[model samples]
Target chain A: MTRIYNFSAGPSMLPEAVLRRAGEDILDWGGSGMSVMEMSHRGKHFGAIAERAEADLRELLAIPPEYKVLFLQGGATAQFAMVPMNLLRDRTAACYVDTGIWSGKAMEEASRYCQVGVAATAKAGGFTTVPPRSEWRIDSEAAYLHYTSNETINGVEFQDVPDSAGLPLVCDMSSNILSRPVDVSRFGLIYAGAQKNMGPAGITVVIVREDLIGKTIPGTPTVFDYKKHADNGSMLNTPPTYIWYLLGLVLDWLKQQGGVAGIEAQNIRKAQKLYAAIDASAFYSNPIDPAFRSRMNVPFRLADAGLEKIFAAEAAGHGLVALEGHRSVGGLRASIYNAMPEAGVDALIAFMADFERRYG
Target chain B: MTRIYNFSAGPSMLPEAVLRRAGEDILDWGGSGMSVMEMSHRGKHFGAIAERAEADLRELLAIPPEYKVLFLQGGATAQFAMVPMNLLRDRTAACYVDTGIWSGKAMEEASRYCQVGVAATAKAGGFTTVPPRSEWRIDSEAAYLHYTSNETINGVEFQDVPDSAGLPLVCDMSSNILSRPVDVSRFGLIYAGAQKNMGPAGITVVIVREDLIGKTIPGTPTVFDYKKHADNGSMLNTPPTYIWYLLGLVLDWLKQQGGVAGIEAQNIRKAQKLYAAIDASAFYSNPIDPAFRSRMNVPFRLADAGLEKIFAAEAAGHGLVALEGHRSVGGLRASIYNAMPEAGVDALIAFMADFERRYG
Candidate 1:
C-alpha cells in the first residue's frame, strides 16, 4: 500500500515502525490477549508500559532525579493555566515572551490567574522573529518567566535558550520537544503537547522541577495541580491509556533513531536542506530571519499569493498532505517533525522544485 | 487465535468488532492515507468523524437539540472538579448522594469550590444499596443534585432515576452509560468516562442541558468551562482524535445492536444469568441487594476467602482475565459492559460452575 507523507502541524506524522508495531499490538498487546486500549490503567501490563516510557524519556533527556515527568491529559493548553495555578505560589505577576500563537495563548490563559508581564514580544514583526534576550524586560520579583521554545504557526525557533536571570524559566516546548537535547537543569519546568514531535494529541508531557510542585493557588482544580499528578505518577485519574502506549512505542523508536543527539544531527540537515531549497528559489520565500527559522515547521509562500490553494491541492495530489499553513498565517507549511523522514523532505523539496518549474 | 475475556472495571472490555476494525485501520484510517491518530482535529476528515460520532450518539440516546454533547479529555476525575467549577454558578452549596468511591471523590473535589451537602449516603450499609430518595435530605437552595448511576467498585446500580425536585439532576454514569435507555430530559447533565461501555480512556462523553452552561465560577479553567466546549464542539483544544473515531465506530455498532433498548434486554438477561449462577451455588455469593446489584459489575466472593487467589489464577489459566476486584473491595468483580457478549458471560458462568465442581 502507498503511504502519503503527513505534515500536520501538531497531530503530525509518526514513525512508520512505531505505527506498524502499534497496529500489531492494537488487537492484543504483548500477547496478553487484550488490546492496550482495553487494559486497565492500574493493571500490571500497562503499568510496565507507563513506567518504561517514563524511564526511557528520562534517559533520553537526562532528566534530573529532582524533576518529575508527568504524563497528563488536556494537552498543553491545560498547562497554560496549570503553570500559573501551580507555580504562582506567592508572587502575583509572571513574565512571558510573546513569540507567536502558542506563547500568546499561554499568556492570555495566565492573565486570569495572575498579572502577566509581556517581558518581550515579537508581535510587532508579525511574530516573524524572536526578540533579542538582552532587550527583554523581566520583573525580578515575578513568579517565573515563560516562553515557547518553537512557534509552530510562524515557523520561528529559539537559536539559544533565553535567560530568566536566575529566576525559574518555564518553557512551552510543545512543538520542538525531544527533537534535540538540551540541559534539563536550566529550566524549572518544561511541557509539551504530545501530538507534535512526541506521539498523539491526548497526552501532555510535563517535566517539572520537584520544588515547583505542590504549591498551587488555593481552589485550583485538582486535575490541574502539578503536585497531585506528580504525587500519583499521573494516575490521579484514568490516563489516556492507548495514547500513553503509543508514546512508549515512539520513545522506543527514538532510541533506535540514536537518541536526541543523533536525531538532532539529522534534523539539522533536513531543516538546512529544506531552507536552502526555499532560499534558492525566487518563486518561494520564507520571511523569517535565518537565525530563528524553525527546524520543525517550515512555512513558505508562493511569489504569487493567489496560487496558495492550487499549491496545497497539488501537493495533496502528489501524496504530500497537510501542506497548508495555519490560517492565521496563510500560505504553505510542511511540518518536518521528528517523525518526518529525510526522504519525505527530499520528496517535498523535489515537489516544490517541480511546482516552480510548472508555474514560473 | 485464543482470546481472553477481560473484565477490567474501567478501560475494560471492548467489542471484538471494534478492536478488529481499529487494528485494521491503525495504520491508515478510512483510506485517508493516514491513521486517525495522525489527522488534524480541525481538518474535514476528523471534523466529519467528530460530527458523525456526535450525531450517532444523539440518535442512540434521542438527545434533545436543546442539550449539548461534548467530547472532552481528562476523564471523569477531571469532571469531578469541572462539574463544580462549571455547574456551581451563583450557588454556595451543591447536594451529592454519596454511594461509593467515585461519588465520594466527586464530593471531595467539589468541596474545594463550594459547600457540598451529602443528601444521602450508602456508606452506612457498606455501600451495598442505594438509599431511597425519600430519606435524602437535599438542599433546595443548592446548585444541582449529583449521584453516581452505577458505582462500578461497589457493584451497586440505581434501579431508577431519583427525583431532583426542580433541581437539575447530574449523574456520573461512567460505568453504565449506553448499557440501557434512560430519559435524557430528566438530567441537567450526564458525564461518563469513555473507557467502559463507550470506547477508550482518553475521551469523555459529557451531555449537558444548553441552559446549564456558560455560568461557571470565576477563575474556572477554560477547558473546564462547559460552555466553551459546547460552543466550540469540544475542540477547545485538540481532541483525542483516535478515541473520538473509536467512539463513532462504537455508536455505529450500538445502532446495529438495536440501540439502547435492544441492548438493555440482552444486558438484563446476561446479568440475571450470571447472578443466578453465583446465588444458586454454595461456593459463591454476591452480597449486594438483589434489587440494587449492578448489572454491569457483578462482585462476588468465594466461600473460602483463601481460595480467592486460586480462583483468580485458575480463571486466568482458563483465559478469563482481569476478574480481580478493586483493591478497595477484595473480591472478584466481572464488569459485563455493553461490549461483553452474552456468550462471554455464559463462558464465565460455565467456568464458575466447573470450578465449584472441582473445589466445592
Candidate 2:
C-alpha cells in the first residue's frame, strides 16, 4: 500500500499505527468482545477509556489540578459561544484578538453573548501575522480575553499566549494544540477542536478553570452548558465515544513520541525546513510574517496563479494529497499536524523543489 | 463470532450487515484507500458520501424538495435549543407535550428561550401513555408545538402525531425515526439522534422546513444556526464523516428492508411478543400503558426488585445484552430498534419466560 501524507487542514492525517489499532479493535475493544463503536457509554470498558483519555490528556498537557478537562462535541466552533455563555457574567464585554478565520469566527460567535471588543486584529496584515501583544486594546473590566493560538486557514500562529492581567485568558488552540509545550496556568480556558491535531472531527477538548464552571446563561442548552458537562464527566449526554477512543490512541501515540517537548522539537525543525524550502524558491512564497507562521499549517502560493491546479495534481501523483489551500484563500496549504511525519515534510519539500525546477 | 443482541436505548443496536460493512470499510472506504474517519470532509470522497447519504435519506423519508436535511453534531440535545432558536420568532410561548424524559428535557431547554405551555402531559399517567390530542390545550398565539414521537427511556410511543391546525409541528423521533412511515409535510421539523434506528452516536439528523431556515437568537453559535448549516449543505463545518457514511449505509439497509412500512410491521411483532411474555408472567410486568407502549423500547420490572440484577446478569449470559434500564428508572429496557430482528426479540422473550419459571 502506498501511504500518502494528508494535508487537508482538519479531518487530516492520523498516525497509521493508531488507525491500525483502531481498525483491529473496531469489533472487539480490549477484550470487551464488543466494538468500541457498539459499546455503551455507561459500560465499564468505555468508562475506563474515557477516564484514561482524560488522564492521559491531562498528563500530556501538564494540566493543573484546578482545571477540569472536558471532552465535548460540536468542535471549537461550539466553544466560541460556550465560552461567553459560561464566563461573561458580571462583565459587559469580552475582548478578542482577531488573527485569522478562526478568531474572526470566534469574534462573530462571541458577539452574540456579550458586547465584543476587538482588542487587536491581524486583518490589516492580511491575516498573515499575529498582532503584537503591546498593540492590544484590552478592557480591564472584560470577562475574559479570547484568541486563536493558531489560524488554520491563513497559517498564522501566536508565538506566545497573552497575559490578561488579573482577568482570565482563553485560547482556541484547535489547529496547533499538543504540537508544542505551554504553561497551562496562564489561561483560564483552552479549547481545541480534535480534528486538526488531536484525533478526529467530532470531539472538542476544553480545559477550563474550576471557577468558570456553573456560569452558563439560562438559555444555554444543557448539552452545551459547560457546568452540566463538567459536572457529569462530559457525559451529561451521549458523547462521541468512538472519537473519544481514537483520541486516546492519539494521546498514547503522543506519549511514545516523547511527549509535547519532544514533539515540539520535531515540529520546529519540520516547519523550518518547509518554510526554508518556500523561501528558497522564487516559484513559491509564503506571505505570513516571519515571527508568526504556523508550525502546523503552511500556506503558500505559486508565482503563476494558474499553476495552482497543476501543482495540486502533480503533488497528488507523488502521493502527497490534500495540499490545496482554503477555498477563500486560493493557493497551497500543507498541514503538517502532529501526526504528520518528518518524512512527509521531506517528501513535500522534495516535491516543491521538483515543481520549482520545472516551473521556475 | 457470537453476535450479542444489544438492546441499548439511543446509542442502540445497529444492523449486523451495517456493522460488517463498516468493519470491512474501516481502513478503505469505497476504494478511497483511506479510512472514512481519515477522509477530509471537503474531499470528493466524503462529499459524495455525504451528498448520496442525504439523497438516499431524502428518498427514504420522502422529504420534500422544500425541506433541508442537516447532518448536525451534538445529537437531539442540541436540537432542543436549535428548534426554539429557529422557530420561536414573534411567539412568546410554545406548546409541548410531556411524554417522557426526552420531551421533558426538550421542554426544559425550550423554556429557557420561550414560555412553554404544557399542551398535555403523560407524566400524571406515570409516563406510560401519550395524552390524547383532544386533551391538548395548545395556544392559538403560540409558536410551534413539540413532542417526542417515541420516548426511549419510558417505553412510550405516540401512536399518532397530532394535527397542529396549520401551525408548524416539531417532533423528536430519537427512538422511533425511520421505524415507520409518516407524512413529512405535516411537520415543520424532525430531529433524530443517529444512534438508534439510524447509524452511530456522533451524528444527529435534522429535517427542517426551508421556510424555518434563519431565525436564530443572537447568542446561538453559527455551527448550530439553522441557516448557517442549511446554506452550507451541512458542510459549513467539518462534519462527523464516518458516522454520516455509516448512516447512509443504514439508510440503504432500511430501503432493502422494504422501507419504513415493512420495518414497522416487524417492529410491531417484536414488541408484541415481548409485551405478551411480560403480561403473561406473574413475576414480570411492563408498567407502560398498552395504548402507548413503544414498539422500539419495552421497559419492564420484576415483581421482586431483588431479582433485577439477576435478570440482567442472566440475560447477559444468554447474549441478551444492555437490558439494564436507565439510572433514573431502574429496571430492564429492551430497545428493539429498526435493526433489531424479530428473532432477537423472540430470544429475549424466551429468556424472560425461562427465567421467571425457574426463579419465580
Candidate 3:
C-alpha cells in the first residue's frame, strides 16, 4: 500500500518507523506473550516503559530537575480547566492572552473557575499575527499569566517567550511541542496534547514546576488536581497504557533522529520549502506576518476561493490527504509536523505548483 | 513468538484476530493510505469509523434511542468525578453501593462534589460477596443511585440488577460491559473503561440517558460537562482517535461472535472450568461466594501461602502470565475476560494442577 502525505492539523502524520515498529509488536510485545495494550500498568513491564518515556522526554526537552512531567489524560482542553483550578492559588483572577481559538477557549474555561483578565489579543489582525508583547495588558496582582505558544487553528506562534515578569507563566503548547526546543525552566508550567508532534490523541503531557504541584482550589476533583497526578506519577487511576507505550516509541525515534534540535532543523527546512513555494506563486497566499507564522501548521489561501474544494480533492487524488484547512478558516492548511518528511513537503509544493498552473 | 494466556485485571488480552487485523492496518488502514492513528477525528474516514462503532455498540447493547453514547477520555475514574458533577442537579447527596476498591474510590471522588451516602458495604465481608438488595439503605432525596456492576480490583460482581425503584441507577461496568447482555433501559447511565472487555486503555465509553446530558453544577468545567460533549459529538477536543478506532474493531469482533450472548456462553464455560479446577483441588481455594463470583476476573489462593510467588513464576514459565493478584489482596488472580479463549483457560488449569502436584 502506498502511504499518503497526511497534513492533518492534529492527529497528523507519525514517523513511519514508529508505525512499523508498533505493528510488529501488536501481537506479542517483546516476547511478553501479550500486546502492549494487554499489559497491566502496575506490571513491571509497563512501569518500566512509562519510566523510560518520562526520562526520554525530559532529556529531549531538557526539563529541569524542578519539573515534574505528567503523562495525563483528557487532552489539553482538560488542562484549560485544570490549569486554573490548580494554579489560581488563592487569587480570584488570572491574565490571559487571546491569540486565537485555543487561548480564547482556555480563557472561557478559566472564567468558570476564576475571573479572567485579558492580557493581549490578536483578533484585530484576524488572528493571523501575534499582538506585540510590549503592548500587552497585565494586572500586577493576577494569579498567573496564560498564553498559547502555538495556535493550531490560526497558525500563529509566539515568536519568543513572552516576559511574564514576576508572574508565573503557563502556556498551552499543544500544536508545536517536540517540533522545537524550549527552555523548560523559563515557565511555571507547559502542556501539550499528544496528537500533533508528541505521539497520538489519547495522552497529554504536562510539565509543571514542583512549586505549582499541590494548589488546587477547594472542591476540585482529585483527578483534575495536578498535585494528585504528580504525586502518583500520572497513574492516579489506570493510565492510557497503549498510548503511553506508543508515545515511548515515538520518543525513542526522536532521540534516534538526534533529539529536539535535530528534528527542529528538519521542521525549519520543511516549513521554509513549503512556505517558499506558496510565496513564489501568485495564486497562493499566507496571511500571517512572516515572523509569527507557525512552522508546524501552515495555513494558506488560494487566489480563487471558489477552487478550495477542488484543490483539496485533487490533492487527495494524488495520495495527499487532510490538506483542508479548519472550518473556521475557509482556505487550505498543510500541517507539516516533525513526522512529515522533507520529501512530503516537496511533494506538497510540487502538487501546489501544478495545480496553480492548471487553475491559476 | 508464542501467544500466552494473559490474565491482567485491566489492559487484559484481546482476541487474536483483532490484534492481527490491527497490526496489518497499523501502517495503512483499509486502503485509505493513512494509519487510523493519523486521521483527523473530524475527517470523513474517522467519522465513518466512529459512526459504525457507535452503531455496532448500540446494536450489541440494545441501547435505546433515549440514550446517547459518548466516547470520552480520562478513563472511568474520570467518570467517577463526572458522574457527580453532571448528575447532582439541586440534590446535595447521592447513594453509593460499595463492593470493592473501584466502587470505594468512586465514592471518594463523588464526595468532593456532593454528600455521599453509603447504601451498602461489602467491606465487612472482605469484599468477597455483594450485599443483598434488601439490606441497602436508600436515600429518598439523593441525586442518583450508583453501583459498580463488576469491581475489577476485588473480583466481585453484582449477580442481578439491584432494584433502584424510580431512581436513576448509574452502573460502572468497566470490567464486564460487553461480556454479557444487559437491559440498557434499566439504567440511567452505564460507563466502562475500554480495557478489560472492550478495547484499549485510553478511551472510556459512556452511555447516558438523554435526560442526564444537560445537567451539571454551575461551576463545572466545559470539558467535564456532558452536555457540551454530546453537542460536539465527542470531538469536544480530539477524542483519543487511535484507541477509539481500535475499539471499533473490537466492537465489530463482538458482532461476529454473535454479539454479547454468544460470548456470554463462552464466558460462563471458561469461568466454570477454572472454578471447578480450583474447587476439585485441595491445594487451592477461591474466597468469593459462588453466586456472585465474577466470570471475567477470578482470584484464588494456594492453600500454602508460601508457594504463591513460585507458583506465579512457574506459571509464567509455562506461558501463563499476569496471574498475580492486586497488591491490596494477596495470592493469585486470573482475569479471563472475553478475549481469553477457552483454550487459554484450559492451559491455565493445566498449569495450576502441575504446580500443585510439584509444590503441594
Q: Give the top-scoring candidate (DockQ).
A: 3
lDDT of 1 by residue, A1-360 (tens): 677898899798889899899878877887899888889999899999999999999999999999999999998889999999999999999999999998989999999999999999999888889888889999998899999999999999997777889889999999999999989899999999999988988999999999988888877888888888988989988999989989989999999999999899999999999999999999999999898999999999999989889989998999899999998778999999999999999999999999999988
TM-score-wise, the better of 1 and 2 is 1
lDDT winner between 2 and 3, please give it: 3
* CA lDDT, candidate 1, residue A255: 97
lDDT of 3 by residue, B120-215 (tens): 999988999998888999899998999999977777887778888678999999999999999999998999999998898999999999887687
Residue A250 shift from truth in candidate 3, angstroms: 1.4
- Residue A317 local lDDT, model 2: 85
Query: What DockQ does model 3 achieve?
Result: 0.85
Between prediction 1 and prediction 2, which has the larger lDDT? Answer: 1
What residue runs in model 3 are displaced by over 4 Å at the alpha carbon?
none
Per-residue lDDT, model 2, residue B14, is 74
DockQ of each: 0.77, 0.55, 0.85
Q: Which ten residues in a row have the lowest lDDT in candidate 2 chain B?
A: B25-34
Put down candidate 2 lDDT per residue, B1-360, tens digits, no spaces.
Answer: 566788878566777787778877776666666777778998998889899999998988899999999999998888998888889877788889898988999999899889999989988768988877887888988888898999988888888778886679999998888988888889999999888888878999999899977877756677878888988888888888878888999999998998888888898888888888889888999988788888888899999989999999999998888899999999988989997788889898888889988999
Please compute the TM-score of chain B alone for each predicted structure, in the order given. 0.98, 0.97, 0.98
Model 2: which residue pairs collide? none
Residue-wise C-alpha lDDT for candidate 1, range B257-276, written one tens digit per residue: 99999999999999999999
lDDT, residue A119, model 2: 91
